[model samples]
Target: MSPSDQVLGTSVEAGGATGGDWVLHPDRALPAEPGVRALAREILSAVSDLPIVSMHGHVPVEWFVENGSFGNPAELLVVPDHYLVRMLVSQGATPAELGVPTRTGSGVTAEADPREIWRRFCAGWHLFRGTPTRFWMETELVDIFGVTQRPSAETADAIYDRIQAVVDSPDFRPRALLDTFGIEVVSTTDPAWSDLAQHHRLAAEGLGDRVLPTFRPDAVLTLTSPTWIADVARLGEAAGVDTGSYAGYLEALRLQRERFKAAGARATDHGLATTDTTPLSDAEATRLYADALAGRVTPEGSTAFAGHMMFQMAAMAAEDHLVMQIHPGVLRDHDPAIAAAYGPDKGYDIPLAIEFAHGLRPLLNAFGHHPGFRAIAFTIDEDTYSRELAPLAGVYPGLKLGAPWWFLDAPDAMRRYREAVTETAGFFNTTGFVDDTRAFCSIPARHDLARRIDAGYLARLVTEHRLDLDEAVDTATYLAYRGPLEAYAELAS
Candidate 1:
């Protein structure tokens, strides 16, 4: 049996805090004031166990396809998490010390011992204080795995062995854990060229509704990427359309979208440094495509082409009925050396100050009212919450504000999110709490944190007489479940 199959007694009950556990407080993220805390507890209890509706995430599809057991605690929790790695790196812990694999030709070899890596992580637990990474890891260890002892230099081995026992059980396999966690539907991010055979296989096995793919065309859409030409060719091959011409390229993308839709894709995700969505004339776009293929497209021309394609993508969503997800304003891989050593997304991407008002005006103006179109705008730039995104989402029929994303998906940031956007966009105009995580085991913890934060926010509303207890509980349920269902309703159709 895989380690995850050993079902002990229920370890996740409220108010189960013991001397052994790190954080099992019933009112973990609730308001501190007595009356507010009581009210928040009642509100949180209403939605605490709602089936998770994970509409956007990066959990690997192969985990479901293979139904494989996770290898070890470190592989499951440590190596893959940039949130943990980045923190340790900041505190003088080398990536090699934590077992973060270096890219080939980077001249650095990561540590191979899981126990040694876990020991380092446990010893450095103090570094995670006041961070969401600690919260999630604590919950994963204590609640999910039934770990009781605190992780420290002395207790690391004991904790590791206890977790290893459960992880070796059949119950710990990825598919079993889905039911164990009560996840209703989870989406995996897939590139545009993907065949989605694994998704299809899941459908054949009668699990299609539980796992879905999200179409992501960023590689093929970014005209300036070094691999752009090769990515475009792959897209053409996948779609069975020649992408040698601009018209053919657009057709290929549309065909790929159709394939993705057939494979149960409900949404398309884009990552951009800016949300500029200006269009180019057909002739101009055609000329740019030819120049790009011929290796003559200038840097200036590439930027214009990227913006033009964003407009085109919106147009495609309007026609194809895929919910659009755009997260802008991150300078990806801020440290070139780290990026070179660790291929991208090793948590070096830094947030930039961005203006959504003017940058997104063109796209919103064009497709904001399209009957078949819906877009969710996510930002790491907190400045834009009330200043730009909330106001835009408040007025636009086709747009909704996404949950606090990446660096902002934390306890205090979550409270700040509600405080900033609730007055403008209101609760229903936001997309609810999406974990947006690659760490599969942390999904429940992430969602739990968001719910606790929301419950506190709603309790405040009740105290202020803006809402009654019943209304607050109802909204809590909506934010946890129905809101995501509504935001990505295309998933059902």
Candidate 2:
């Protein structure tokens, strides 16, 4: 809190003995069962340094194209990390102190040392204990930056200075780090109406082979979006199609999908309250479109239109090679005030009870058997993993279960998912891990956790002899890296 503590290069006493070189004893957190430990170690070694294929995330396009230095630690780490702020908020740490961008709030760093903000973060580091947050933070701190000491109130300033120095170095730029981190491919979610100019630039410069784009039409499809009708109209304009008719809307979507493909997008993403794969007749769809344009569409009508659109989008994907991904079961931005101020994805999104049994039947009925169609379904509803999702994916040629995500993106969640469905759906029936993050630095950390957790999960199977040790190691490595490339084939070569 004072300049007197500003010993930038000075050594400070770390509170914990496991500070220096504490690179998260990977797979050490799993349950201790006979033969489990040895098999886990084998699986971990197999996937220790495999390349990451991130098929879904919210990475800034400009970070790669612009390749500019992130200004400070708070800006790079705390400001964009929803997981960090979400945990911080739970522990009575305000966003203002953590340097979160908010509605006209005064952030810490009035003195602008950057180290002070990090010190504050370190002081509250205990709040993340027993959480995936702690796992990820420690991994990032040690593995990525080679920090020898655990972040604490005492060593916060010292570590901050070291990180600041590392951050400003040329090796820490987005593209450079992507290469260093062994990121084979990274994809970002973009609106269907987006120009994707940066993606074009990256492609033109050969960076497109790694930094890719995914079409996220959540805004255009969600009837709850304030500018739904306007968005549809703009979608029409962007796609060079007419907007006055229901047929024209479908045409617009097709054209936009083409445009996205041309702009280096090989995947389409939908985020909805549920996989409400309902069907609507042409007349009903036309009526809904008209009402939406007139701002007279009922909530029921909006839901119908969204459900209808899912089927329609699948139809498009059937014709194109674009992989369609469904992210269902989130009650997005539960905080009305936060929604009003910062909009969606401000760390207030909550998961709700969702049904996958009958909810996806209509869409599955329409598109599931099509050889040309592909859909990767993700759910917060773990109850469905074995009961519904596994059976469906096992049978449906086009369907693949997406990785455990959002609320269930933790280590336990990953292990539980593999245990629940891998027996029935098997490894090939499920798409592998996706970062699904807004934070850039956490990409490697997230992937590392998924890998280690998967290694540990497979180790149990190998120990039980449910799977051969060699195959378990291979599958674990695939889940960490290769499976993503296969699921997102067009994006990753």
Best by lDDT: 1
Clashing pairs in 2: 20-148
lDDT of each: 0.88, 0.78
Candidate 1 weakest ten by summed lDDT = 1-10
List residue ranges in candidate 1 displaced over 4 A: 1-23, 491-493
- Model 2 TM-score is 0.91
For each candidate, what TM-score against the reference? Answer: 0.97, 0.91
User: What are the per-residue Cα lDDT tens digits for candidate 2 across 300-320?
Assistant: 878888888887888788888
lDDT value, residue 3 of candidate 2? 11
User: Residue 185 in model 2: shift from native, Å?
Assistant: 0.6
1-493 per-residue lDDT for model 1 (tens digits): 1122236444344443344645567677789999999999999989988999999999999999999878988998998899999998999988888898899999999999999999999999989999999989988887777776778999999889978887887778889888888799999999989988999999999989889999999898777888999999999998899999999999999998998888888899999778889899999999999999998878888878888999999999998889999998989999989888978888899999988888788889999988888999999999999999899999999999999999999999999999999999999999898878878999999999999999999999999999999999999999999999899887322
